[model samples]
Target: MIKSIGTDLVKLERIKEIGIEKFAERILSPKESVVFKTITNELRKLTFLAGRFAAKEALFKCFKKGDLTANYKDFEILNDENGAPYIESKYTKELISHITITHTEEFAIAFIVLEYAEYK
Candidate 1:
């Protein structure tokens, strides 16, 4: 069964001005941090951070309003060998999540859908 849907968009330029290291520390999980550190190209780094930030924001919106307990680091967005992104977090482990992230030179956008098993 579908539980919730959320979407967010982030400005690439704004993230670029925030400084990669600072932004990564504020949002990236331990494993994500390692990936961020390994990125050598500045554009790739900015897009990576922006995608994660937007994804987390979108996921947070999936919860009921006034639920602000989730921090950016709590939701880790990681890519598989094929470069498909997936969510890894205790909060979302039981729920199936689907995410689509896209970016241009100016903006990054993400859409998230949460689902749970249906019992008959």
Candidate 2:
């Protein structure tokens, strides 16, 4: 059963101002970095980051982190073979029920569904 669900939206321009390279390195995985490298406009890059940030926040909402602080890198956004973005959390791998992310030129969004599963 779905234990938790979350969704977030972010502005493209706001993320663009933060510098794509810096934000990607800090928040994205190595594979995600490669994808970000292909973006030409800062707005697009921010849009990608915003989607990823939202996904992470959604993941956090899925679990019981309590007072535990979360690092952005703790959950990396990765692309599937079909080039769809998905969540990859090494530490809390078992609790996720499902995740989805979407982005547009003006905004990015993500949703996460959590299940009551064991985490290693």
lDDT of 1: 0.91
Clashes of 1: 0
| Candidate 1 deviant stretches above 4 angstroms | none
Instruction: List ranges where model 2 is wrong by over 4 Å.
Output: 38-44, 64-67, 117-120
- RMSD of every candidate to native, in Å, equals 1.6, 3.2
Query: For candidate 2, which ten residues in a row score worst on lDDT?
Result: 89-98
Per-residue accuracy of model 2 over 49-115 as CA lDDT, tens digit each: 8888888777766665744776777777777799776677664565754678888777778887777
Worst-scoring 10-residue span by lDDT in model 1: 61-70
TM-score of 2: 0.76
lDDT for each residue of candidate 1 in 1-120, tens digit (9 for 90 to 100): 888999999999888788878888899999999998899998999999999999999998887563567798999999999999999998887788999999999999999999994521
Error of 2 at 26 (Å): 2.7
Q: Candidate 2 — what's its lDDT?
A: 0.73
